[model samples]
Target chain A: MEWIRFFITAALLIMGMISFISAVIGVYRFGFVMNRMHAAGIGDTLGLLCVVSAMAVASGLNMDTLKLLFLIFFMWFTSPVSTHFLSQVEYYTNRERARFMTFRKGGEPRES
Target chain B: MNIDQAYHLLFMGALIIFAVLIGIMLIRAVIGPRITDRILSINMIGTMTICSIAILSGLLHEGYLTDVALIYAMLSFVAVLILAVMYIPAKSTRGQKQSRPEMADTAKEKKLQQSQSGETTRQKARKKGKKA
Candidate 1:
């Protein structure tokens, strides 16, 4: 039983780390800021989710697990808001956005 | 190896990986070209730190570290928010009026009328095309 629990935790932790590694790679390789933001969002949501769940699995049902789960909830709610603001700031400040983004018929900027 | 030793080894390895990843993120933050890129890198580093803290708590069997991780998460959120708020233009009417105090009332009225129309770039382009 102990070995089973250890394996589960290990697997989950590895999965989370893989997600983070991919996210980091994406952030590094992507050409545009908005594309990089997409990569960062992956880490904020999926990477954290998997890592916290792995910790919860390691610790079992306890107050610590409750706290960790609450952390995930907090991140989920706030990450999107932060991403939105970051994009808004980018939109307002980036004068050369035409080079990286395409405009729709309605004047909305979309990734080219 | 025994279960306890195996668990310790797993966590230690994970911690090492996290440390390396965090360091890479730090480099990215330092080299990020635009202000927003730097902010984004900082946000990523904050998240990886939180992950490290949570893993540490599990490895150490201390509940207090979870509390630290929670608080760190909150601080990270606030940091990103404040950084973003700094870049957003303070385009409030009062701010505009205060900045343009020398403008006559009629000019201000005309400006407000144009702003109220909410003209988009597509519309402006069409107007320009017609004028041309």
Candidate 2:
């Protein structure tokens, strides 16, 4: 049973790591800054979710596990909100909107 | 290796990977073009740090790690909020136009020259009328 749990945890951790590294690469390689921000959302929320869930399982159903779940829940709730606000700030401060392909086709400017 | 030992090794590997992810984010935060990009990178690092603390809490059999994770979450929230508020006033102030005196002087000189030329043309026409 312990071996099975370990295997599960290892697999989930590897998956999370791979997603995170890819997100970093995506942030670097993506043309538009907004796109990079989108990539970051994946790594921050879902990637963490997978790894934390696995760790909670490995730790068993105890108080520690509950704490892990709580952390995951907090992340899910906060990460997107923060990302949204940050993106809004970035949009307002910079004139890089032209660089985004999505803005090229008659897109309206956001109200400040 | 025993199953328990394998679990420990797996945890160690995961911890190492998390560390590497944090390092990568730090690099991004350093080189990112804009302030918001840096904030995003820092936020990601914070999330991963919380995960690292959780894992360590398990490994060390320390209950305090959970408390630390909770605190980190709160800190991150506050930091991001502060950043958002800072952006607002700074952005609004940027939109206000404050032209330099030198630029205004040059513009004023060009307008004066145009008006003088127009007056000279009118004066010549009046002299022609007087001659007639």
The best candidate in terms of lDDT: 1
Tens-digit per-residue lDDT, B1-132, candidate 1? 788888889899989999999999898888988888989998999999999999999889999999999999999999999999898866446423344222113344334434655665566898999999
TM-score of chain A of each: 0.92, 0.86
RMSD of each: 7.2, 11.6
What are the lDDT scores of the predictions, listed in order?
A: 0.85, 0.74
- Residue pairs whose backbone atoms clash in candidate 2: none
lDDT of 2 by residue, B1-132 (tens): 777677678778778988887888899889988787788888888878887887787677787788899889889978987887677534333576753222112334334444545444544677789999
Q: Write the per-residue lDDT of candidate 2 for residues A16-44, one digit (tens) a residue.
A: 87888888888888766678888988888
The digit string of per-residue lDDT tens for model 1 on A1-84 reads 877888899999999999999999999999889999999998999999999999999999989989999999999998999999
DockQ of 1: 0.49
Alpha-carbon runs more than 4 Å astray in model 2 = A101-112, B89-132
